[model samples]
Target: MKIVTIFVMMMHITGSLCAQVLQDIKLNAPDMERGLTIMKAFGKRASATSFSSKDLSLQDLSDLLWASAGVNRPENGKRTAPTAVNAQDIDVYVLMKSGAYLYDAKTHSLKGVIAGDNRKMVSERQTNFANAPVMLVMVSDISRFRGDDTEQKLIWAAMDAGIVSQNIGIFCAGTGMVTRPRASMDTEGLKKLLVLSGTQYPLLNNLVGYPNE
Candidate 1:
């Protein structure tokens, strides 16, 4: 009887700890008509405004990041965006006011990439990050492609990264925020900043923020 009681207590503690650590998160919004229509309204138009430096909630950030590249459909492990040959070579590095993190598609969580708020490293101009809340650095491990032509492979990978980037832009539009897929970045600087030693190249960056109105 004493052994049974102790085992039950241990099980309860374990369950509570698991619940605390593994949070269940999902996207919530103001219904489809209101949300989807607005999101679709912007289509391909990049945001014209900039976001103010305000702390966004975990829900907001999670949904935004999920919309960027999270897996939507279940069957084949496909995501909101398409990848060339489904190689999924593109990796998204999220630089926020706190630190840098990588998107774990399978776990639907942000894993630490680097331990610092190095948003300025993403852009030379401080203004670029001044009103920004989150900046996603799209990287590609070019070696993943076993194509005969290396340059063409790089081009195709870049194309895939662009697809995912556009999704983020559209998602921002839906949420009444601002976003811009910026190619005007110091790639080498970013690679070093994010501590990308070899082959992991920062291809593009997308800046997101709540519009300063």
Candidate 2:
């Protein structure tokens, strides 16, 4: 009887902990009027070396995601970043202090993936970037491409990931935030943590935050 009672207590505690995990975040609509002109943004586009740990405002975060790859055309469900053959294979996973989330472009919200601060996994050897409030990890599921040529599919995946990363860079430059695109990260660790399949390859990431000035 005592053993059973203890087990029940443990189960209750576990349930409570799971309930405390990060929940889905409904992102705000993209602010079309915000940001600098395209020419000005291009002039200011530069990778950030240092970042502040302050959290981004909800509006800023929403706009950033939308500009990165969110569905710009709701009617056809097209994204801001173009993909080869309209594959739309790139998926953006958000790593923050609270937990990791998968961006659901259809709903314009962040779906909680796991309940932990896995930002370090994305930072890898670049410990300096671990402190950034948010990191966008771009993963490519090559299986989305309708082709038997694995090599060709991989090429298309790389190109699509690069385009999305560029959008992130331009958005940060146009706005006041800073970002740096990187190809380094703990791939194995992220793959396991995110429960990704063999076809899902993590291609790039961007550490975004306010400048550490």
Candidate 3:
């Protein structure tokens, strides 16, 4: 007769998988000018940094996810990043020192997933993922596409992920956070680890954290 919230059960598994209580919180609106942020991103777009030991707060994590793909126009429910035909298939899953969460763009909140401090497994070993406190794993659910061709859906997914991925870079640059988006992942392996659905395909892993001196 266990009665615990999904988040609590997914943040820590220290002999109590369902011992914690976690829920989504409202994200803080970014306090930067859009045009200025874009300009700054373009300036250092090529000089990306990665592998940092600094960590980000939950609020910082919330802000980054929202900037990357949260709903921008609530009237029409448009996202920060554009999707092909507005499919909006990309899903941003965040890995923090605490746990992993699936970002819900519409609500601008995080849905807890795997429990325990498994964020390190989000990327391959010998990579900079360990240094960064947050890693955004972009996944696209092809079922959202109207088309039935799996191959075509995957292509569209990649394109959609690219746009969202760049948004992370731009946001990090403008906000003074460091990020490095990389495709160096074993898609199938990660899918299994995350227990992703058959139609959901991971696109890229964007590392985010504070810069080191």
What lDDT tens digits, residue by residue, belong to model 2 across residues 7-28? 9999999998886578999999
- Model 3: per-residue lDDT, tens digit, 1-213? 255676566555654645443445556665445434477667865434555676786667767888899987899999999998899999998877666778888777887776555565666763545667888999999999996788888889999999999998888777778888888766776787678998898888888888776
lDDT of each: 0.73, 0.95, 0.77
Which wins on TM-score, candidate 2 or candidate 3? 2
Model number with the top lDDT: 2
**Two-way TM-score contest, 1 vs 2, winner:** 2
Q: Rank the candidates by lDDT, best first.
A: 2, 3, 1
Q: With candidate 3 superimposed using the best TM-score fit, by how many Å does residue 144's alpha carbon deviate from the native?
A: 0.4
As a whole number from 0 to 100, the lDDT of residue 202 in candidate 3 is: 89
Residue 11 lDDT (model 1): 100
Distance from true location, Cα of 123 in model 3, Å: 2.6
In candidate 1, which residue pairs clash? 51-210
Model 1 TM-score (2 dp): 0.78
Q: What lDDT tens digits, residue by residue, belong to model 1 across residues 81-141?
A: 7787787778888887667788877677877655556787776564645558788888987
